[model samples]
Target chain A: MVDQLKPGKSIKDTYVFDLKMSERGMRINRLAEWLNGAENREAFKSDMDAVMDRFELTGEEKKLILDNDWLNLVKAGGNIYNVVRIAAIFDVGLYPLGAQQLGMSYEEFLETRNEKGAT
Target chain B: MAMIVAGIGTSHVPSIGAVVDSGRQNTPEWKPLFDAYEPVRTWLSDERKVDAVIVIYNDHACDFSFSKYPTFAVGAASEYAIADEGFGVRPLPPVKGDLDLSAHICRHLVYEEEFDITICKEMAVEHGLLVPMDLCFPQQGEWPVKVIPVQVNVLQHPIPTALRCFKLGAALRRAVESYDRDVNVAVMGTGGMSHQLHGERFGHLNSDFDNWFLDKIESDPQAICGMTHFDLMEQAGAEAVELIMWLTMRGAMTPDAQRIHRNYYAPMTTGMGLITMQDAA
Candidate 1:
């Protein structure tokens, strides 16, 4: 399903969030979107497995969330913004998540940025 | 009669809002970006005397999810809530809306221009709108100017075309002018100046493409009007496609609009670009 949405010409590491990706990642995306609510964040923090069960996330989806695999979550059709919400629960920011996705330490990623302090 | 006094094109990076909220504007890393807006803040409030703003921005999966996303959504509510995008909501007051003006724009777009925009009575504005507002306006207890939120779907695919977004701005101009009340409006195009945050190409920044886009958006928007989503994503990363929203602001102005102020800063991942324009005298 995720492979179906690739454009005729593809960027090396970019993911285009299309209808198919949206449909495939609906459960995880919806669960992440719900994290916008404070109560929902708390609910997930405590008994996360129950919340995952309620959202009916697949075993792989559960593993991605538990394993802190930001890149796989995105590759599995999770929208980047929705994935950011899930990562925020663990106090991970967009920069850190990107660093992890790029297989670099946060400091190494900061060195690549023009304004390291901007983070 | 209502008039669009000016148009502002800016990057609505979320971190800017965080800096403003945390009182880190004086810090070296952010001072330059915040300082650039000081003159803009003064100009809009003092010189232009803008009463309301039409903000063209995209929802970053905050308020409206993929479940039911509108390609083009216009806010017709009396107020808009600041969205909590995972982090706590920014320390800002609710955005006051100009319902009469909003309704007027909505009616004109549908009836006269034939742009079938979704009318949102309850819309929660995220960084796309807030960051621009934070940059251009100073808030006392309440915001200085009321807003009419115009949300474009730049997140998901099959979103509005660049031409369509521009046409929406043209329709918005007509909508604003058709209103009977006398009001000065400023249309703000917020988001993008090239930066991606998705995958291995996460830290993409194209200052050259950003500069070229700024030049075209000001001088020959027609050149950009034909840009395909693939072209934009290829040149400037995928998320930078949000630059299309800026065309909506350009489309609202006269073809010979005077470029008043221009600034570009690429200190971080996103190339923060700003351009202010006014209709030729």
Candidate 2:
């Protein structure tokens, strides 16, 4: 059967969390979604490998989380909101994660913003 | 018959909610942002006397997961719990819902309007809905107005087109007016002026586009309704496409609606913009 719904046109650095991306990142997204609960966050914090294993994340996916690679995680189909959940567990707030993605130090990125004190 | 008294469009940035929760609203950096909302809050609860609000917001993977996401979901529950968006639930009272009105709108959309929306008997709202409520309404022990949550899928691609969202709002106005109850209702279109929160384009902000949008949303919404998601992402940033939800509020109002209040503030990542509209008599 022909697929009726067409994929969104590719933008430079943006990854639209469409059906294909969602399917590819399902394991990681689900794992991150579970972090909504405090108990699950603690379990993941205690034994990272076990939690990742339980979620059936692939080796590459596990490596992405292990390396704390925010940019590549999105490339690996990790939804930004879901990736945020994982980042929170590592004490990485959105601004710092964003700065890392932009290849700038947190302070450097703050300088780029209109109001540095906004954070 | 119920009347649509006004429409509110505001950015529902999660960090703003954090500022409120952490008692930093009075701090130097955040005070201006919170202070901007003071008059707008008074107008909502006092002048308009909005008894209930239909909040059109998108869930940020908090309540519904990727497993079974709905394109459009309407809350039919009597009350909704605050979602724990991977951090923790905000310390806010459960939002009360108008069950009878919700059911009426659900039925009208499905049968009368041919908009087959998922009816959620249970929904936990995230920052998308709560942040706007925090800014617009006064929170004592409980919310002053009942809420009817209308969740849209802006996260996943192939989401509804910008025009479809506006049409949904028009349909909603009909649904609300048809009800036998005599109540003053307001529709809140929450989320985004401009900011992308992922990948290398994460910190993108477009104040010019945000300002243009704030103007067009009131004066020439038809121009906005014709824009594609790609166009919005390119010009405003990826996540800023959530601005389509504002069309729902515009769609629910008169084309000649007067803009009562307007404010623009870009802090860190998001372009926080706010506007209130009331239909011309």
Candidate 3:
């Protein structure tokens, strides 16, 4: 993660990673919850597993959270703030000022390279 | 005899004051947030013996709108009106302003300071200021100390960069010290403790980053100071990194100062962070 944060790096370096990390979390959480609530739970599991597979997290990030290694969790490249950023990206709260500050739209900031499940 | 007294950095979460005064703290999830302010309350009342507060806060487009925003502005009035924040303005009393001192600050920043700040004679203050005031000076129906407002540009794009905010603080220190009249002042830098409102990242809270930032603010501001707008925008979320304003507050303090009180809570999407440091050193 430190390598991910480099020399002469701007706060944006950390932010884009966090923003992407958060979006992954929200999409995964919603899919999991939706799968659990399904009338046809078994079919939803297959659908959810596919959705989960599309999540941006690598195998390592899931392992870190599962192992509950809070320290290594950050090392794996996300922390409470990272998770919260995902929540904000998925969940909604205060009116965001960054998009306007960055001269971009909210949708523009959320645009992912993978348009498979994009809004 | 103008002297800098204290530097305050906290989240001016709108509706904080009304929530606290109405006993919102008694609610199970909200107590820790408000309880953290008890020390700040005691300090501002007894220790921070600040005669006039030189509020170094930014406007949230509540008073002056996007149609005509000034890079920097100074309030040169005896009292300020609570402008409508889309919702009606809060029922709080009008904030007191020391016209004479404000006039002096305005002149100094324009002439001696060489900073071209808009001298606002009929400016109205919005929640960007009033909420923080309600917390630090809670007992007052009307505020006790006079205020000299220095409004920065944080609402619109191309805001003063983080380094610029810090430099402005140092310049403000020079302005305060050069004032001919005798006055004790405190500079407050409000906003940012890692809460992102808006977009998909609206509820972001960076406690780790927040803690790291607090330490850097005291020991090595250069670490934070050297950061770029892109860095802050990306790492701390575009909105959450406005903590640069804290540099203005930091600029008012001695490089090696004493931190009095610090607290951080995430009750909602935004971080309810608070810190109080003084230059008694």
Candidate 4:
């Protein structure tokens, strides 16, 4: 079905945030969405286990968030937007998360951009 | 009667807002992208005389979370607050909205064109909408013109097709023309040229596809209208499929609208682009 959707070419390394992914990552996304509010963010930061239990996140989902394993999170169906939200809680940003996804050191990723140190 | 003065297409990458807020426009890393907007600011404030802008952007799981995400939403409020997308809220002032114009468009879209959009009484706009405002009209203290935000669902699947977005733009033109006010409205579509922010292809950037898209949007938007969402994702990175929003801006103008200005820059993960068009007199 995914191949049928692509008319001619295929993006090898990208994960499209479609319905199936959304369904699979519903619990993780919900936990991330709750971080939008200040109080919710504070509560999650204070008691990570209780918050994960409250959101009914699976053991694997909790591990993904705890490890800052962004690539695995995406492979486990977490959207990048939501994953970034989760990453922000630990002060990890998009570039660092993306570097981890590409299996490169953050420095190697920066060297690839036109503006290396801008971020 | 109201008139459509101009239509604009821009990329609303969140990092652009950070650069503007930090006062780093002239810096070596950011000069090209920021300098390109100088002419745009002048044209908007002087040449176009746009009294209100219908900003076509998408919500990035900020205001409208996935729990109750609407496919299409229209802001009918008099003012919209800036949302805090994971980070703290931006230091920008609240956006002023033309409630009368918004209500009229809402009514026209539903009854006249049969596009049922969710009407938002209180909506908080994220960088998707505010970044465009900052690029075109840097808020000295107050915004130069009012805005009506039309948010689309580009994140989740079953998003509106390219052709449907084009038809919605046509409907918006009719809605704006039918209004009895003496307003000069500019339709602004903001998002994407080519970049994906997920998986192994986290920083995908396709300048070739983006430049071709810039040309096609001006000369033959119909060519774009026929492309499937998957086709766009494959060629222009997955997240770049948000280019569908640009069709709404193009559809708001005459088929032979004159292209006035065009710019493209791929500084980072996203292919940031800018284009302006005016309806032929």
Point out the worst 10-residue segment of candidate 2 chain A by lDDT: A1-10
Q: Once model 3 is optimally superposed onto the true structure by TM-score, how far is the C-alpha of residue A6 displaced, in angstroms?
A: 15
Of the two candidates 2 and 4, the one with more favorable DockQ, higher being better, is 2
**Candidate 4 C-alpha lDDT tens digits along B1-281:** 99999999999999889988899888887888888889988897799998999999999998887768888899999999989888888888899999999999999999999999999999999988999999997788888899999999998887888988999999999999999999999999999989888888878888999999999999999999999888898888889999999999999999999999899988778899999999887
Of 3 and 4, the candidate ranking higher by DockQ: 4
Which model scores highest in lDDT? 2
Candidate 4 clashing pairs, residues 3+ apart or interchain = none
C-alpha positional error of residue B67 in candidate 1 after TM-score superposition, expressed in Å: 0.5
Model 3, range B128-236, lDDT digits (tens) per residue?
7877787676635778788888888764445666777788888888888988888888888887777654343544566678888888887788788888655665656
DockQ of each: 0.60, 0.65, 0.03, 0.64
Which of the two, 1 or 4, has more lDDT? 1
TM-score versus the correct structure, for each prediction: 0.97, 0.97, 0.70, 0.97
Off by over 4 Å in 4: A1-10
lDDT of 2 by residue, A43-99 (tens): 999999999999999999999998999899998889998998999999999899999
Q: Model 2: per-residue lDDT, tens digit, B105-167?
A: 999999999999999999999999999998998578999999999999988887888888999
> B15-99, model 1: which lDDT tens digit per residue?
8888887889999988888888888888998999999999999998889988999999999999999898888777789999999
Measure candidate 4: CA RMSD. Answer: 1.8
| DockQ of predicted model 4 | 0.64
Better of 3 and 4 by TM-score: 4
